[model samples]
Target: MTDSSAPADPRPRSALPLLVAILALIVAGGALWVSYGNATKLAASKEHAAVAPPSDPAIEQIKETLSSLQQAVRGIQADQQRQAERVGDVQQGISIGCDPTEGLSTTGRAKVALGSTERAQHAG
Candidate 1:
């Protein structure tokens, strides 16, 4: 009735945009698929790493060395404390025999006498 649609109007108006949209959608889907695959592969690698046991002997040796050093430090601290106690005991014993008015200045003698008195009080 309209001269066979005038040769189908030569070109469809919506064809080009529709083709572009379809292409864009395909590209987006491909990109998403690629990213998903990469993410899955990364997750699998992490899982494997988590499941694996520690394999380095040097790390274990270092841990053992650190523990030994800690023990040595504790022993050294105890020895220092014992030596300090012995020194304090010797000072108190010396203070008990010495006259506060001889050889030592007034302030020094007072400090030594006070230390001896405090040590005696604490010991008793």
Candidate 2:
């Protein structure tokens, strides 16, 4: 009882194009991530290389001399401090005994004066 003009059933479409698009997006994202990481590493290495080397040998010598000069200045400052402390100690301990006849009796002073006069007379 089928007629010759009956309608045909619809066929299902393949999802291959959608799957391919998803795969392409994943590949692109992975490539982008790898490129970004490589760029960062290259930039860091360049910066380190740029800073690690001196342009001239004279610059290195000058840096060494400058450090030695700083050390010498520190040593001189320490020596000066020690000298100042020594001077302070000497000043604190000092006393004067100006009288030549100190710790002598009056008779001893007279005898010394007489002896000096006798020596002066003999020399003249």
Candidate 3:
């Protein structure tokens, strides 16, 4: 069939894929640039830390105060130990060789005495 009745069309094709590719490349480049900037900042901070910082008087004063507090605590512990030894000596001196009879009530003690007396009478 040879029907020559329609005209030739002259429209361009859609380039959506190419536009998306270019947008992705731009986004990737921006991300890389931000990452590089952060890396440089971290590097600069590390270099500053590597250098020696100036000594502050407040820190030295705090260190001295800490040492004094430690000394005071040690003194208090030594005093407490000496007092404990003295108390031990006093307790040992006051201790007597006797049976303890404080836990039983009066009724319990009477029952125990009556039972002992009845046992003695039966034995006799």
Candidate 4:
């Protein structure tokens, strides 16, 4: 029942081995892709972990000054509110003008206008 003259099944038996090798290679490539993705996510998470300014003394001092200035702004805002409330019965809106170079502290005048309160709230 075997036709030995039919060109020996007309295909190389090594075809099976080649197919298996290709499949193995594809599986290995998928595993490598997954591993690389995980490694990238791990690296990105490490990079995103609450990075901040260096812990140098100068940086710490600057942070402290910023915090103090933020509190001062809150205090000033509260005072302004109180003043507004106290003069609610006045006939006209309050008008106070002074030189920018003389009326306010340099740092206060600079950052206070930049919504430092909101920025500090987030930086906290």
lDDT of each: 0.82, 0.78, 0.78, 0.72
TM-score of 2: 0.42
What's the C-alpha lDDT at position 104 in model 3?
43
Worst ten in a row by lDDT for model 4: 89-98
Q: TM-scores across all candidates?
A: 0.53, 0.42, 0.43, 0.35
Per-candidate clashes come to: 0, 0, 0, 0
TM-score head-to-head 1 vs 3, winner: 1
Encode model 3's per-residue lDDT on 1-124: one tens digit a residue: 6457643555656799899999999999999999999999999999999998888999999999999999999999999998687556544544763222234468745765687689899999
lDDT by residue (1-124, candidate 4, tens digit) is 9887788667656788899999999999999999999999999988888676568998889999999999999999999997676445221322443332344467645744466468888899
Model 3: runs farther than 4 Å from truth? 1-36, 51-53, 96-124
Best by TM-score: 1
Residue lDDT tens for model 1, 9-86: 686577888999999999999999999999999999999988978669999899999999999999999999986875
**Residue runs of model 1 more than 4 Å from their true location after superposition:** 1-14, 41-45, 48-53, 98-124
- For candidate 4, the lDDT comes to 0.72
TM-score of 3: 0.43
Clashing residue pairs, backbone N/CA/C < 3 A, model 1: none
Q: What is the lDDT of candidate 2?
A: 0.78
Backbone clash tally (model 2): 0
lDDT of 2 by residue, 26-91 (tens): 999999999999999999999998886656889889999999999999999999998687555544
